[model samples]
Target: MILALSFIESPIAVIVILGSILVFALYYFNKKQVILRKLSKTRRKAVASLKTNEFVKVHGKALHVVAPLVAPLSKRKCVFYTIKLEKKVSSGKSSYWKTIVDEEKMQDFFLEQNGSYVIVRPVPSPKNYKSYLVKDEKVSSGVFNDPTPEFKELLKTYNIDSEGFFGFNKTLRYEEGIIEVGEKITVAGIAKWKTLNEPIPEYAYSKIVELISDEKEKLIITDHPKALKDSRHSI
Candidate 1:
């Protein structure tokens, strides 16, 4: 009997309390939603403006992102990350983030410790870098190529083997003495048939070196190309 009396007498108070809570929740959610939408818009615009080998700084890390986003995907508007990776981890191998971060709970990570990330655009050089492909023989070629005549000439001059085919392969950035002429290499990459594995008789280490050499020559020759490589290379 007493409970029935209390319910009837305070029905309006209960309604008012519920309404206030609902309003507060909606306002909080709406603010977050707006922030996320703006983030998505910015990312889309940034991606659209990206060049083949150029990367932009995002949440914040040094990621060599090959963009013009390969696959367009969407998540909550506040965050959308185009998938890029560190050297793919060996199954049992551990990386810096892998050790401290839970692979299974990536979202929770973004909510708290979003690091700054930068897309690493492939730099401009005169060489079409190839990966060493390894197939029946354990060697492969590079996934991407440079279509310059000078680049091709340098490869031929070095006697690099590019005959075998693969669908895709990756190469590292240009480095000094590490790239040697006449060095034999085994690589993995996609083939003409769209298969992503095969070894090329050649790799691009030497070619890239030669290309960098030629580029240096041109830079010494003038200020224009020099400025481009310098200013453009820097974020």
Candidate 2:
């Protein structure tokens, strides 16, 4: 208790903590600015205006091009997904959070607006751009020791280390950001039209395009583009 009080009362300690926070904020915003500049060059168009064999930028709710995959932790049907793993560490009298594992996975899906839909195919590559709001949902959290069978399987699939240097003493939390059934999303890429093998109703166009992007153009997905304050997705 004496040590804690002394640290809090010390002006040097307070300044150091505040300075660290400011540095982190500046770094984050600077990176965001670079991303905004790239997105600004993308062309925006309504989904209905989307034509076969053309590159276009559009925003709308996400839908399953096929049966949606069930998120392992949340058990929610989604078209796109991302997961994060964190570890807790302590040193001396101070404790803090450390992220040891960060991974993301996604699948082909459709972006729809005003009853019009376009197929986004082959998942995005490392070069294709994507981002999300900070408001991701937490699926589960607990100590890493004696992990559940499902958790173990997930760790194995992703090759994550549940055991630290000494033992499984770390706390594990699973959180995900998903493109759900009806949530809004934005995408920018080339739409390559292909004819369908079978007839389907509601789709006036018999051809569906496989979306792709070049170095300059990118594939972006987000629930609320307005919240990001980026004009690229808004347009």
Candidate 3:
């Protein structure tokens, strides 16, 4: 208690701690700005005009070449989905939402534009590329309210109990985002042409092209063109 009071009483110590936090916040903000600038500066291109090894951005309706995934919380069919679980944590006189679980999944999908289809591979390579998704669905449960059976099951899978030690419901929030089939979305990546071994529906071309992230560039598959503005769910 003496040490805690001394640390709080010392102006220099408090200033140094606050300054460190400010510096960290600024650094993080700048890093995200750099990524946003890169995305904003890239010019959007037509699917037919994309060249192999070229970096391009394309916007079109999402088309699933394969079976779509069911979003965990909403059960909606989508090419990509991200779920975040946060619990409220209280300290002294302040409370903050602390993230307990963050999960995201994606599959290959097609981007159709003007009768031309380009495959989009959202899986990041070993080069540390990233995908930014904007979650549009959210749900919350707390002491006065209880989660549904499905929500409790999900929490069980993560080994998190829905109730606290006294059997009261814990304050929790869930956010889910998905890129549904036929949803208009934007993608940016390095384009490459690949020869198809078999034919596929809606596309007659024997040789198909795909957008993927490479060592030099990261693939961006987003439901919103302005996803950088709301990137909290980025994965």
Candidate 4:
């Protein structure tokens, strides 16, 4: 009884717990500071011009792209999608979680302004401009149905334990990020000049359009309409 009680109240154990909490707090605070700084810079420099064949930064609503792909977890049609899969791990008297998958998939989409549009190729994320404005929705709140064949393949790829002697032992948590059609968005990048000879892909909504970025410049897409607050944090 004495050993158990001491273990429960050990000073080192207490310090470790407190230290972990402090570390997480610091990380959260730092992340917020960085995001705020980026937002401020974007707001200061963001433009709304829509002239073609010229490099510009703009923000507008997301337009249709490639018939809109269904988000894996949300089942909502969106141009851009990100999904995260986490697994529960158990240890003696303690448990923790590990991320098994964090992936983003997007089709070539357009950002539309007042009767004008730009083909956005959201490729080659910059080092400092990697934060995207997206909403995360919890699709699986720890409970899961029978794994689909695709999910089974993912399990094999990740080497995750799907079954034990009795039954499934692993708990899966699924969440997704979506940039839905008609949603307000912000974009920063170059507006490439489309050649008269070049033809827009048939999947695109329009043929007359300019590209967002080139090899020299990187593209950034965010849901912060005014670059003030990123809606992703609210979720």
After superposition on all C-alphas, the RMSD of every candidate to the true structure, in Å, is 23.7, 7.1, 6.6, 7.8
The sequence of per-residue lDDT tens digits that candidate 4 reaches over residues 1-235 is: 9998898779888899999999988876774355444554542222233345444455667887579977765567888887788877779999888888888877778777665566676653443134464456763333346655555555676676666556754577667778888887766665554543544444343244554555554456667444545433221
Question: What local lDDT score does residue 186 receive in model 4, on the 0 to 100 scale?
Answer: 68
Among all candidates shown, the one with the greatest lDDT: 3
Model 2: weakest 10-residue lDDT segment is: 226-235
Ranking by lDDT: 3, 2, 4, 1
**Cα-based RMSD of candidate 4:** 7.8
What TM-score would candidate 2 get against the native? 0.65
Off by over 4 Å in 4: 1-36, 43-56, 124-129, 141-164, 195-217, 224-235
Residue 28, candidate 4: C-alpha displacement in angstroms: 6.6
lDDT of 2 at 221: 60
Order by TM-score, highest first: 3, 2, 4, 1
Candidate 4: lDDT of 207?
A: 44
lDDT per residue, candidate 3, 82-105, as tens digits?
899999999999999999998888
lDDT of 2 by residue, 53-74 (tens): 5556677777886688776666
Give per-residue lDDT, candidate 3, residue 149: 84
Error of 3 at 83 (Å): 1.2
